[model samples]
Each structure stands twice: as structure tokens, then as C-alpha cells.
Target: MKQFLIFVKKECLHIWRDRRTLVILIGMPIVQIILYGFALTNEVKNSRIAVFDQSKDDATRLITDRIAASRYFNLEKNLNSYKQIGESFREGIVRMVVVFPINFQDDLLHTNHAQIQLIADASDPNTANTLANYASAIVNDYQNALNNDQKLPYNIDVQLRMLYNPELKGAYNFVPGVMALVLMLICAMMTSISIVKEKEMGTMEVILVSPLKPFRIVLAKTVPYLLVSLLNIISILLLSVYALDVPIKGSIFLLMAESTLFTITSLSLGILISNFSRTQQSAMFTSMMSLFLPTLLFSGFLFPIENMPKALQIISNIVPAKWYYIIVKAVMIKGLGITAIWKETLILMGMTLLLLGISIRNFKIRLA
Candidate 1:
């Protein structure tokens, strides 16, 4: 019995000595809980919306004030014309727009009926639907308050206009998100594991003695995976269009170019991971923990980023997948041109260069 107890103590000491194992056991759970607790919410709050109050009467003022006062919405802009609404959506300035028609209160008072137009950016159908519903409920509440148990009920019709995706197809949102998630995971995981496998098999030292520089070695190792990732990009685009019925509304060439850029960025990250990881298992585990969860959470694929806490939103800006996801959505779903997504494209390019530089530097140190 004493011998068995001593063996158990030795095993415990072994586990305690391995910092990576300790982190996976204790630190991962804490991080996962925090991310899930804050980011896994379905309730959309503080959604930015615009108002086009043409009526400018007492009733219109009251209803607009109520909407602006609600916890769910933050009135961001007061649009001047109908043209500004589309510009706001394309620029990502607002999610939903409330337009009170001309003589709105006059119609309500004289005919006991009025209409309020709700125009929403429906590239994300779920958020669009939720915002429209919330606005409609608020309008109904105003109607009831105005009626105040009168024999005749006042009616306010909420005319919902879903731009970009009139049918509210789920594929519009799902395809872009899946594109970002797949490319990020596949490129990062495969490249990391492939490079780490060489180190584990003791072949990397042999290769290091050859004439190729560290940068060339890193480039040669990653090129094949880059090609494989491009093939994946093509397959995903075909499937999204044919099977899922999601159209590539923008320039296919631009989309492919952007995808290639993001793939390179992900590969750079994988090479950096390989520098720190000694085995294929460690490479893979690090890829999943670092790439998978961040792609899902910070990429705005699963949840609305605008609804997250200020701290999480700031953290999300550092995630490369977040910008890629936004680019895909803008180009694929909304059919916006390069002009609309230039900032995001620049950001991805900067990340790729930065990560590639660091990974190559690490490779040189390892080779030495």
C-alpha cells in the first residue's frame, strides 16, 4: 500500500512539473468559461440604428424617443434622405433604420391608422429579423398607449424592408462565416502539424544542414499547404453556390485574391506555432486552442460583435478572422466592390506580413 501511494505521488509530481499540461488542465477551463459566458449570448443589445423621422410631430417624437430610450437599440444617425439609408448600410454605419412617413401622426389621428417603415440590412438575416421584431413591438406599444382603452383601436403598421437578402436566406450569413472558419483552421492546423512532424521525426536537423536559408525553408514547407488551401477555397465556393444557393455577388477574382491573402496569413501563424511546438500533437492542440476558438468567437461568425462588452469588442479587432469574415460578407453577400472593403484588405495584408516576419525570425533562431 505504501509503494502504491508513492507511485501515485510520483505521477502527480510528473503532471505538476509539465507547465503545458497544467495550463491545459486549469487555465483552459477558465478561459473557455469566460469566453462562453460573455460571447454565447443570443440576445442582441445596443444595436446601432438610424432614424428618418419625416413626420416631426408629437406622436412621431414620442415613438422615436421610446425607441432611442430602449436598451436594445442605440440611435446612431438621423438620415436626411432615402438615399442615405443604403449608404449607411453599405458603410456599416447602422443595422436597422426607422423611417416615419410624411404626415404620420396626421394619418394616425385622422384615420386611426399609420405606417412606420423599418429598413434592415438583412445580410445577417437573424439580426435583421430580431431588430425588425423589436421595432415592431415598440410601435405596437406606442399604438396601445395612444389608444388608451378607446372604443376604436389605433393601428400602426410596421413595413419591414430587408435589403440585400429579401428572402432572408440563412445561407447569406452562413457561407461567409464558414469560409472564414474553414480556411483559418485548415491552413493553420495542417501547416503547423506538417512542420512539427519534421522536427519530431528528427529530419528537420538534417534539412537545416542543407544550403537553403531559413526563410526559403519556411516558404517551401508552407507552399504546398497554400495550394491545398486554395483548392479548399475553390471547393467551398462551388459548394456554397451550387448546393447552398449562395451567390458570389461580387467579383470572383477579388474574392479569390482576398482568400489567398488570408490563407497566407493563417499559414504564417501556423509556422509560428510550429516554432514553439516540438511534436505534432502539441502543434495540433495549439492550433485548435488558438485558431479554432478565436475564429468562432472573435470572427463574429457565431455571435453579434456589437452586442459584446467593450473589452471583448476591442480584443476582437486583433483577430485576423474577424476582418476576413467581414470582407467575405461585404463582397459575397452585399456585392460591395473593393472600395468598400479596402480597409479590411489592408489590415489582412499587414497581419500576413507581420506574422510571416516573426515566423521566419523564429525559424532562423531555431536553425542556429
Candidate 2:
């Protein structure tokens, strides 16, 4: 017990003493959370749009005024001709253009129907869709106001209720993802580098010849990192909840438990990497290349897996972070119980066991 405590203390000191490791462990999560929460967002605000109104009537002007007053759009140009619409889009000066035909008011007043053309730049499909929805909503509001005193033969109204994320804040999606990413980076990358650093410095030889068993040595090396990872989890949760207003609708205990499971899985992978890498540089490179990119891209963090190509979807299934991401969204956003995410949880558990078994075998062989 005394030797184990001493070993753990020694490992903690080593971590605390390294400036680069300390910054990455403590600073990286905070920076990533703030950047992703504030900077990267799907919500559109003050998008530039052009208007082409051939009618020059009250109805067209009223609709244009409503669109310009709304926070989602800014009427930057009033194009005179239809040809100017394409020019505005080609110049990249406008995201959308609203065109009202010459008989817009006459058609609306006499025939009770009119056409309003909305042309959006589909270069960024998500932004284009959002712009179209906003414009359609404005037009619908205008139509409802015009017919408030008259009754139509048939009317259909659709009520939209956004669940969990009512405001559609991107932080709600990114917080849990950042948690998964940070935990994996700290546990897998840092641990592998630490072990490889020991081997490079000849400390592994000294530790191997000591009274401690090999597994005990590995445990001591990992215990400090486990505690550090737990601290990071707490920090990320506090920042996400208090700073970003991201809610934890489900069991906090379950969230922490799953996070710990993923941490252990990442640590096992780190152990496996350390067994193969003799230098810290090689270990760090391997962890970054193998863990970081997959967690960012294939885990449905930045893009939805359902929208990805079939081959990439198949490739993403093998990523551990992909399963962890699903578990987190279920627990944190959907407020689901274990039954809802049992499949993902089981997959992570299986991966952890497989990685741990392989790492143990490799470490034993290295000792032999």
C-alpha cells in the first residue's frame, strides 16, 4: 500500500511538472467548449438577401418590410430586373433573393392566391434550408394577416414543437461531444505518451526490476490519469451547464458512469499503443492520428452519420467514440434510461474488454 501510494504520487508529480501536458489536460477543454459553443453554430442571423419587386404595390412592399425587419434577414439590395437576381447570387453578395411578380397584389385580391419566388444559394445546404424556412414563415405570416377577417373554405395549420433543444442552440449538441473528445484525448493520448516517455527515459527498466509486479506498476501509472480525467469531466460539465446553459435532463450518475467507461476504454487503447511505441513522439502521433480525427469526424460530432456516404457510415461503426456519442445524446438530451441506450453501452463495454485483453497480452509478451 505504501509503495503504491508513493508510485501514484510520483506519477501525479510528473504530470504536474510537465507544462505542455498540464496545459493540454486543463486548458484544452475550456478553449474547445467556448469556441464550439459560441463560434460554430447552425442558427442564421442577419443574412444578406436581395429583393426584386415588379409590382411596386403595398402588398409587395409590406412583405419586404416584414422580411427586412426580422432578425434572420437583411435586405441589402432592391434589384430592379430579374437578371440582377442571378448577378447578386453570382457575386456572392446575397444568400437569397425574393421576387414578387407584376400582378402579385391583383392576383391576391381577386383570385385569393399569388406566387412569391424564393431563390437561395444552395452552396451551403443547411444555411440555404434555414433561409428558405425563414422566408416562408414571413410570407405565411403576411398571408394570415391579410385573411384574418375572411374565412376560407379549407385551412390547414401546422404547429411545430422542437423537443429537448427548443431554441436550437448548437451548444446543446456540441457540449456532450466536446466531453467525449476531451476525455478521449486526455486518457488515451496523454497516458500513452506518459508510458512511452518512461520507456524512453530508462525508467521502465528501473520500475520493472523493483518489488512491484508489472500489473501493479501499470495500475499505479494509470490511477493518477484516471483521477485527472475525472477532474476534467467535472470541469467540462460545469462549464457546459453553467456557462453554456446546456441541460443534463437525465441521470447525472449515468452520464458520469458512461464517461468513466469510455475513459477506461481509451486508457486500454493507450496501453496498447504504449506497448508498440518506444518513443513518446511516436505514441503521441499514433494517438492523435487514430483517436482525434475519428472522434471529430466519424462520431457524428461535426456531421450527422445518417447523411454520410454508406462506406463512411460502415467505417464509423467501428469508432468507439461513435457509440459513446450516441450514449451521451440519449442520456443528456433525450433524458433516456439505460434501456434506451443499452445497445451502445454494451458495445462500449465490449470494446473496452477487447482492448484491455489485447493490451494485457501485449504487455505480458513485452515483459517476457
Candidate 3:
């Protein structure tokens, strides 16, 4: 036990002595969390919209005023001709164009209905959809106010209540994603590189010749990173909760447990990578190619996995980040307990065991 403690202390000193590793371990997560929380977002705000009001009447003016009053849009320009609408979009001055026909007010007053055309730049589908929805909602609110206390022939109203995120804050979507990505990168990349660095420096042979067994040496090396990974988890949780106002709707203990499991899974994969790599450069390249891109692409971090092709979805199932992401979203967003995410939890556990087994086998073979 004393020897193991000495090994752990030595490994921790080695890690802390390296300024670059310390910065990447601590500083990187902080910067990434802040960047993702504030800058990268899906929610639409202050989108510039152009209006081509051919009606030029009180009703058209009133509707346009309502749109401008809404927080989602800014009335950047009023178009004189329909031709200017295309030019506005072409010049990237506006994302949406609202056109009220010549008889908009008259048709609504006499004919009980009117037509308002909404044209949006579909180049960015999500933004365009949001913009269109905002414009349509404003128009519908105006129309409802106009028809107040009057019964329509068939009124089938649908009330939409956003379940998890009522305010539709984009940070809520990305905080967990950033957590998964940061933890995975740190645990996998750092561990793999650290082990490979020892091998490259020929210190691995010295460590092997010592009384310490290979398993003990690997454990000593991993213990420091495991502690660092836990600290990273705490840092991210604090930032997400206080700095970003993202709520931990479920058990914090459950979240931490799941995070620890994922960290172990990543570390095991890293150890496996280190076994295959002969140098730090190769380990780094392998970690980036294997862990980073897969986490970013297949884990539903930046894109929806359900939207992916069938084969890609199948491939995503093998990604540890994918399961961890599901577990996080279930706990943090939906406030679901272990019962809700047990399948994903089990999957991550299975992956960890598999990776650990393979890494141990490879490590023993190398020693032999």
C-alpha cells in the first residue's frame, strides 16, 4: 500500500510538473464551456427581416408592428418593390421577407380572411425555420386578436408546451454535450499520450524492471488522471449550473456517477490506444482520429443521431460518447433517474469492461 501511494505521488508530480498538461487539463474545459455556453447556440434572436407591404394599410401596418415588437426579429428594411426583397436576401441583409398583398386589409375585413406571404432564406434550415415560425406566430397573434369573441366554424387549437426547455435556451442543449466532449478528450487523449511519452523516453523499461507490476504502474498513472477528470466534471457542473443557469433537474449523485463511468470508459480506451502506439505523436494522432471526431460527429453533440443515415446510426452505437450523451441528457435535461437511463449506463459499463480487458491483455503481452 505504501509503495502504491508512492507510485501515485510520483505520477501526480509528473503530471503537475508539466505546465502544458496542467493547462490543457484545467484551462481547456473552462474555455470550451464558456465558449459553448455563450457563443454557440441554436436559438434565434434579433434576426433581420424585410417587409414588402403592398397593402400599405392600417392592418398591414399593425401586423408589421407586432412582428417588429417581437424579440425574435428586427425590421431592418421596408421594401418599396418585390424586386428589392430578393436583393435584400442576396446581400444577406435579411433572413426573412414578409409580403402583404394589395388587398390584405380589405380581404380580412370583408372576406373574413387574408393572405400574407413569408419568404425565408433556407440556406440555414434551422435558422430559417425558427424565423418563419416567429413571423407566423406574430401574424397568428394579430389574427386571433382581430377575431376575438367570434367563433370560427371549426376551432381545433393545439397548445405546444416545450417539455424540458421552456425558454428554448441553446445552452441547455450544449452544456451536457460540452461536458461529454471535454471529459472524453481529456481522459482519452491525455492518458494515451502520457503512457506513450513514458515509452518514448525509454522510462517504461525502467518502470517495468522495478518491483511494481505492470497493472500497478498503469493504475498509478491512471489514478491522477481519474482525479483530474473528476475535478473537470465538478468544474463543468458548477459552470453549467451557476454561470449558464442550466439546472441539474435530477440527482447530482447520479450525474457524477455516470460521468465517472464515462471517464473510466474513455481512460480504458486511452490505455488501449497507448498499447498500440509507440510514441506520443502517434498516440495523439490516434486519439484525435478515434476519439475526437467520433465524439463530435456520432455522439449527437452537434448533430442529431436520429437524423443520420441508417449505417451511421449503427456505427454511432459503438461510440462510448453516444451512450454517455444519452445518459447526460436523460439526467440533466429530463430529470430522469437511473431507471430511465439504465440501458445507456449498462452499455457504457460494458464498453469500459471490454476496453479494460483488451488493454490489460495487450499490456501483459508487451511486458512478456
lDDT of 2 by residue, 208-318 (tens): 877887767877888888988888888888988899898889999999999999999989889989998888889989999999999999999989999999999999988
Candidate closer to the true structure by TM-score (higher is better), 2 or 3: 3
lDDT, residue 23, candidate 3: 91
Query: Where's the lowest-lDDT run of ten residues in candidate 1?
Result: 28-37
Model 2 residue 285 CA deviation (Å) reads: 2.1
lDDT per residue (tens digit) for residues 1-368 in model 3: 78888989999999889988899899999999999998888879989998999989999999999999888989998999978988998999999999999988999999988999999999999889888888888888887888784657797788899989999998888988998899888998999998888887877877888787777888888999999999999999999999999999999999999999999999999899999898788999999999999999999989999999999999999999989999998999899999999999999999999999888878943433
TM-score of 1: 0.60
lDDT of 3: 0.90
Candidate 2 TM-score over all chains jointly: 0.91
Which ranges of candidate 1 are over 4 A from the true structure?
A: 1-155, 364-368
* Candidate that would win on TM-score: 3
lDDT of 1 at 312: 97
The candidate with the higher lDDT, 1 or 3, is 3
